[model samples]
Target: MAESKPKFLILGGLGFIGRNLVKHLIDQNAASKIRVADKAIPETAFLSDHFMQYIQHPSVERIQCNLSNPMQCTRAFKDDHFDYVVNLAAETKYGQDDTVYKQHIFDLAVNVGRNVEEHKPLKFIHVSTAQIYDADKKPAKETSKVKPWTKLALYHKQAEDELKKMSIPLIIIRPAIVYGPADTSGLTPRFICAAVYKHLGEKMKFLWSADLKMHTVHVRDVCGAILHLCLRGNPGEVYNLADKTDTDQGKINDFLGILFRIETGFVGSAMSTMAKLNMKSTVEGVNDKHCQPWSEMCKAASITNTPLSPFLPQELLYNTPLSVDGTKIEGTGFVYQHPMMTPVLVKEVVDGYILQGMFPQPKDYPRPTPIPPPSFETK
Candidate 1:
């Protein structure tokens, strides 16, 4: 049996998800101790006094190290001898070239896995991405067919394969577009873009068509899922941690417009097509290969019984036949606390970014959806 409150070492512990996990673990008292490391933690104003409070303590240690460098990676594992090691470190961009991604980032995933195997921890948790699922489907589960092409998808897939081959007892979690307070990557920018557009009172058109799907989850919820898997998930198994609802691009846009009080319009089809038609590699001259720096127009939307909106970008929804079946995790007694709705997440992320001052304010930032009181979203 696993020791109660195992000591944890989190290699990618300072990135968006890593930070959330550390915060959550502290608040919940989920671990005996946590050692966090990353290439370099970017300094941001978004970190609050509360965040600073938690950053340094007897219970945690933060380090600057690159995992792709095997010597640095091996030294961490040998020095710590931790009970659980979560590899949340990855170059999580969707619009970058193959060479840039593999060299600087993705190989880091394999490196972490190798170190975990060498260290022989009680459990190794690999936080991966759901991009591996073929965009042709929506709400894809662990059983979903794998697609090998997407740059984002391949990175995690390769990591999983390499780790499994090494016989590491791992818990792999693939989450969709994640957003919430303190987010430095992914959908936060779209909110910044939308918020600034709202402030400017400028009419902005979405790059993707109305029907595309953009699955999302709150950063806190993703943290919860990771904690749950660490506490109770089956090793050598994979799970998809995403919004309960399979939300689409059109719905996300309409909701955000309503919440922010902006008149929103959408462009149709994939931005890739838009780029192709324009004879460029990207819309707005942004390279699709390095999609990590910003959010991308993902696949088409999936229909779901759960209604998640009132603030999501509708045009951003592309249909993804992927549907994540979380029954196994549910069976393991895992529970999700957040509503997994777009508006709810959008509110948290947008407000958090504004508070951080990282998001630039536009003169006409639109305030369409009247800010809901904290009690409004009460489940």
Candidate 2:
């Protein structure tokens, strides 16, 4: 007789990482039944056709509920005994009010954590961010100084601290700038900016030094690590999930240049420092140039609607390095599928949106071939 597939419960299942995780489980045949609990439904999530097909897979069970509400969160876990419960729900937007973070992120995570204690899954995985560390030249370890540069990171750190007090079997994963399909917040903005610059026929320049540390990891690796840790990680352990690449702003720009066929550079620190002194004006100046031209490009292509945009919130526009060390997770015998970011991989992100008709097709950019999901390593 074969072993029964592990049952899974995924909180925030329709989110960027949530949807991707569900797809990963289905592709690997890793789960018997995946109950996806989230506030938003699939039809309203603006998922691509490629991702939509996977979310609607036979093994997935979608349940729409507000995890922020304590009653709903408790009921979400009472439905079945799960082998693994991964929490991917949170307020991901930057530059929001403190109240917003309190209600949606810090409060909601606590609510879910309390309920997880009652249900008692084999492993309760909590997704955190690399931003909890202070921006520095050195990569941060799990035990690094807790000086979060962003408000979102502050709340995540708060939640991490709170969740530690509980008796739940917890495994925390902190990932560096996660980039891939269904990524609206991470590197997608820069991709949109590159396309905008291509349309304007100008060199794309950025604030801060080109060598600023901007570590990254692919979404596939994130999902793989989550599953790997679910089976093999120690309770009360925290892991940093990043790739081998020591990616910097310049490295990312080089790939963007290749994809958009445009020139890219950074304003020297002298000018960038001045810009930072007056960040509000600087942010408005940057967003002002991209928004109108992007609209014009979409209009020319007859694309009346798209989720893609070149807007960067003030918090993200700040000159803070997000360097993170990923070597720790490797000690657990898990390997990254995309150990490094490449020009082709960066181009693949833009091409994916283009294929989905969410992004304006670049001139001379060939149609993208369907990318096969690489075999996930659970061992």
Candidate 3:
């Protein structure tokens, strides 16, 4: 007799990470059937052309429903029996108020947790942010102290707590700033925009200390990690997903400056200090102005209408740097495809954005040739 194929359900499948996960599953032929539930339709979801084929594929099902609504979530899961259910739905905007975060992020997690508890899928994987950890320059472990320095992290921590209280077996993954192709959220697109604006000589100053650590994981690695956890991860265990390389804003700025061939200067500690003095009001004011051109560019490029906040709240920045120890996930026999955010990787992402019309490559921009991944050295 032939074995039955595994079925998977991805809530928030239209999101930056969720879309990539769906593509990864389909490309790997890992599932017999897949269901994608989200509040946005394919059009409004701002999915790239690469995803259109999968969305139209016979084995995939796209259901549009607000996961925040319990009745909708209930209906969405009523008749489906999934081997795996991955929850990527959450309010990820960085500048929102606590009330907004609690309602959209925390409440959504509770709703999904309750439904997962009821459905009892074979495995439940929840995507979390690295922001839960305090700003320590050292690599943070899953066992590290969780001092949420931002409202976004605070609410996500609350959501994690709510999920822990649920009866369903859960695998929690905390990922650093995720970037790569098809990335409209996080830092990728914003960096692209900054490069464009810088090339145009519109914005020339970096916001925070250039030395601030900027831990990151590629979206594909994130997908790979999620799959690894689903198959081999122990239930009720937490893993931090990040690369071994120690990347900081200074390194990123240098790369961007070289890539764009534009000389830029850091804003320095004095300005950052003032910004932190009145963090909320200052960030909101600056971000609102920045969002104007960003929104316009996104609209022109058909990308998702994501807000353009390059930095988190000032208080969060002043806290310890949010670096992490990804050895836990790596020890599970998973290797990062793009371990370090090298120049080649950054070029690939920028090229992807240019292809999508989100970024305009400068006429004189020197495009770096693609390089193969580095060979891992064993101790």
RMSD of each: 8.6, 2.8, 5.6
Put down candidate 2 lDDT per residue, 1-379, tens digits, no spaces. 1139888899999998999999888787889889999999988897887777777776778888888888888877875789999999998888899999988888989998998888888999999999999888899998898898999999999999999999999999999999987888999999999999888889999999788889999999999999999989998999997888899889989988887889999988898999989999999999999999999998988888787789999988888889899889899999999999998778778877887777888776666767664344332
Candidate 1 ranges beyond 4 A from true positions: 1-4, 42-46, 268-276, 279-282, 285-323, 361-379
Show pairs that collide, candidate 3: 135-320, 135-321
How many clashing pairs in candidate 3?
A: 2
- lDDT (10s digit) by residue, model 1, range 1-379: 2247788898877777787788888778777778888777635323544455566655778777888888888756766678878887787655677876785556787778777777888788888777787765446778888884456567668767877778777888888777776664556555555554565466656665655666777788888887777777778788887766666656777767865668787645565465456543334343232232222211111212211111222212223433455445676777777746757566766654444433433334444233332221112
Rank candidates by lDDT, best first. Answer: 2, 3, 1
After TM-score superposition, the amount by which residue 266's alpha carbon in candidate 1 deviates from its true location, in angstroms, is 1.8
Descending-TM-score candidate ranking: 2, 3, 1
TM-score of 2: 0.96
Model 2 lDDT, residue 134, Cα: 80
The reply for model 2, stretches above 4 Å from the true place, is 1-3, 371-379
* Residue 182 CA displacement from its true place in model 3, Å: 2.4
lDDT of model 3, residue 125:
96
